[model samples]
Target: MSDSQLAKLPTSGMRRWQLTPKIRLTSVQATLADDLELRGEGDAHLSLVIMCEGAGWFRLNRQAIQHYCADSFWLSCASGRCQGYDFFPRHHFYHLLIVDFSPELLTLVEECGLRVPGDEPKVFSAALAEPLKAAMLEIQQGWNEASPLAALHLESLALNALWLALGQLQTQQEARPQPTASRLPSRERKRLIAARDVIRQQASEPLSIEEMARTAGLSLMAFKRGFRAMFGITPWNYVIECRLKLAQNLLEESALPLSDIALRCGFAHASHLTRFFQRQYGQPPGRYRSSCQQVRMAG
Candidate 1:
């Protein structure tokens, strides 16, 4: 698509880019004044949505309503045809990226001997990983560069995002059990979601399992069990993940000391952050920051 065509909805803060013949990226970053409904038809393509900031409800082919939040992602495959409806509440701020891969891209992936799951229409959502989040940020930052090579740069970044997303999808499918009716009631599920949001929003604060259980309105045992069942991770581990993610972002984006980052991310001390950061990212925070600085300087 041409640049003019890409910005058809400038008033709504929506922009699109044709990274390649078979790959496209669309971004929406806006604060809603009224409830918005986005409807679209899907052909034989796969779509990956990276939600950097926002919460919304969407359904594919009139399927069950699925909720998406900031720091999460959604993936959908349309083998033949599909329809999608996304609803965003009024007065909410949102920033999200939608990357679509045409059937030709899928063919290329298959030729490369990578199986693309789901022959029929299907959708999945999960928390975004720290590395994938960082990559998406890079894509956004590079999207508007006015260089002749910007298209090539964006194409490579888009493909990298797809690769990382597909890898995460494959891992989730292999590690988790198949879908079934949820055991938790809808109200309880909403409560659990609220509690999870608390962890995401308040990772830097002092948070406890008891407080999280109270937020979910469930007993300690029930909260623990249900949280694990719903999210595939324990509450405490999710907290640590959030903290580490914040630390990683700080390490890359700021020149703050490690101890300051640890405190800002709710770790007790620099050593505590170092232990988990190394276990999760395979490097100490100092080395990670140095490497990121080197990359920035070289770039």
Candidate 2:
């Protein structure tokens, strides 16, 4: 939002409601009059925002994205050093829910392997699907209800919403076809390192074969062949393996929820993590966590 746009917002009737229900969930529900704007910047917490009612436009850092009601976005604190966003309403009224994940949750998400498919600090969903919408609604209700332990409900709701959003993104990813390997060029170690770094940075986002090849300074075929030959695995498999290892470490070391561990590790949900962990370690992540705890107690 520009300075002129910010000045045009109604001085009155734009109310900001905030609730710190739990250490992990910070909820901000706001209502703004048309042409009004909200601007903020921060690091240290991941944010999940929803334009729950009415249309709005927002810019996160340099990228401008518009949203309608139910449109959702997640912003990671680790990216861009610091993250910023400007929000302005297009309709007569705009309502939004902004949920910030605490540093602990963010760390858990990373450890559990919650990889999103983009380098951009903010990842947007054009519109949330039914599952995500329901979760959002439940959180909203929990936030509105003045009851003891409402924070607990909101915390669960936030995790559920996060999982749904991740699952939706995962579905979209699975629907897209993977790149086929092409003709190979001469192998180089530097290219392999460059490609590996790119994958690590973008593990949370979708894997882009073209981007990897370009970063590695190799042709598509050459990148594929060289990456596989050097790493003993294809680029995609290597990414998954790296994430799974991180998940294993979190499962053993942290008492964070499994769903959180799933997000951190880049898996869509706990079930997805379970399948992969079971395949690799002969037990699910929950079981692994339990076993580790048992061994610790025995020792």
Candidate 3:
């Protein structure tokens, strides 16, 4: 958000109300035989509910009680007034990611190959929830696994997670029309741009395969195959190679210790730094430093 815009946000007891650059998320666990009423105006591409305990009614009107177990439900609505009560999930903790976005933003997600045809929201179970949770968790655990993790990897995993959820939604209702390969214009170029931006910003952080896929705006399999074809190396390998190259430059020029150098270069520690350096340069960092010293002497 722009500085001025951020300043407009009420800081007074609204700790729960926060915003990410592109998303806003909220959660609640209320127990009441009472019916809840919601009257508001907002637009979003998707709203997800991961119920851990308890059950409640869901609908614009208190018309239906979606008997939700330990399952996930997605309510895909663009905008206008939406209401529901006990719409309350029966679970230990009701987790949710209510994505508030413009129609244009939703189109951007669609362009990124996220939403399947006729994709909507409804309650789902382990068969459906596990993969989405797994993908999301993978994104978290591997946030910095550049060679192992990249933005594309995160995006892909997120898509897969949503896809699994959507697939379940399909079974609940009629399937949405499947988007054809043609629907998404080849976005490899945009993907590459996103990758460059992400890599440049967090050169020291690892990028997951899923993140790379997301960056490339492609599915996991498609992103892998496409990234390799475009870059002449797998995305994961390319990321490692890129970080290693940066490390070498810093090691040769900076006065930082090997431990600091490793951390700065994205390695977990000095040892990781040495291992990759030796593998790529045919010598450990100590030797490489000595060699560089010799070169400087000759110069």
Scored by lDDT, the top model is 1
Error of 3 at 106 (Å): 35
Off by over 4 Å in 1: 1-10, 107-119, 177-299
Candidate 1, pairs of clashing residues: none
Q: Compare candidates 2 and 3 on lDDT and give the better one.
A: 2
Tens-digit lDDT track of model 1 for 179-202 = 322977888788888899989999
For each candidate, how many residue pairs have backbone atoms clashing (under 3 Å)?
0, 19, 43
lDDT of 3 by residue, 199-298 (tens): 6667778655566666566776566545544555545556567788888887688778889888877777898778778888899988888788789999
Across residues 116-156, which tens digit of lDDT does each residue of candidate 2 receive? Answer: 22345535354666677677667766665666587666667
Better by lDDT, candidate 2 or 1: 1
RMSD of each: 16.9, 8.8, 14.3
TM-scores, all candidates, are 0.53, 0.56, 0.38
Question: Candidate 3, which segments miss by more than 4 Å at Cα?
Answer: 1-186
TM-score for predicted model 3 compared with the true structure: 0.38
